[model samples]
Target: MEHKALWTLKFFNFDPSKTQNKRRRQMLELEEMWLHAYDSSRSYKEQLKSKWSGPFIVKSVRPHGAIELVDPAANDQQSSWVVNGQRLKHYLGGEVERLSTVMKLVDP
Candidate 1:
């Protein structure tokens, strides 16, 4: 079974590295991106926890796929950090003003 799995991958010329490089990403500034939250240690009781965080603002898209993210809720960003694009996925949830009480009157 292991040999068949290897053969299938080889036959399909599956290369995850190349696939990652070929992924089309046009992460514009101020767009929302969710950072993947990975937990190595987990308790069985914590099943309701989320695996992703954000709807974070895309502060900048750096060269070589590095992204700098900023929290939308936090006006002060002294603890902002950079992360690889692989650890993030674009947030698909649309902006719904009815659910939240924040308003942007002008561009800051």
Candidate 2:
């Protein structure tokens, strides 16, 4: 009886293939993002280093979630490289707020 009940539950359960993954891509629009370091072979001295690198500018967004990145500090566009969107996270610069203040040009 116990084995029969387990079999029935599996048939009624939801299918994983039908489920949609909403978090499939990181950022859709072109913006700054950080690339996860894929270097598994690391030195013993550099064990404490952060795995994520770059606040790289998003040069373009390709089909099938492919993203091209370029170094903002670099003068030429030759330093650009392509990476997957999953391996990247947005670089939202400490979430700083922008506020503008107007000043009088001359005294009345």
Candidate 3:
């Protein structure tokens, strides 16, 4: 059987008025969720290791407020994020890992 590579993207939007402390906590939790998702997906892990050279990266696209993730092998696979035309974040692969919905937490 041949294994085909797949990509994912996830989006999460937060209220602009949330407190900084609340936002910080939310981001930390979101990172955990992202890690869980990454670990559960075998293809994602292998691709990240086989393709990326350094640690995984996340880039923020402002205004629209989107974050792009890069692992390794980004350049080879065109996996990094671009703003206007400039490439942002470290190269993880020629192709980027599929993104997923951003995890949001309600203020507590």
Candidate 4:
């Protein structure tokens, strides 16, 4: 029993040092942002729909990997929210334009 318990603990343990090796946030303040949609909101047939939405502006970066974003399409400050860095991606306008062009060619 003791041997089994020791082996399980050793196997399940994570190296604390490894957690520090994660890549730094790619998004920055004042940059355009996109938040990923919830998986439950998507359907299998409409899988081609974009997984991200918004060209929201990055309002501020918070400690512990949270970011504040503002939706340019909305007039009220209530439209803003703080989200974790993992849920966001930097919005690239040129890439979006290129993708739309490609999609038009493929679909029409």
All candidates' TM-scores?
0.38, 0.38, 0.24, 0.37
Model 4: per-residue Cα lDDT at residue 10: 84
Each candidate: what lDDT?
0.66, 0.66, 0.59, 0.64
Error of 4 at 50 (Å): 11
Q: Can you write out model 1's per-residue Cα lDDT over 1-108, one digit (the tens) per residue? A: 999999998979988877665563434321323322223234432642432355776789999999987876776875466878997876779873444578879978
Kindly indicate the candidate among 1 and 4 with the higher lDDT.
1
| Local accuracy of candidate 4 as per-residue lDDT tens digits, 1-108 | 999999999878966555544322344321324323333345643652432356877789999999988876776956777878887877766554332333445655
Model 4 stretches astray by more than 4 angstroms: 1-52, 95-108
Question: What lDDT does model 4 reach?
Answer: 0.64
Superposed Cα deviation of residue 52, candidate 3 (Å)? 25
lDDT of each residue in 1-108, candidate 3, tens digit only: 122222222113444556687989999999999998878897777875664456555554555545555545455544665333243345555776677899889999
- Could you tell me which 10 consecutive residues in candidate 4 have the lowest summed lDDT? 23-32
Clashing pairs in 2: none
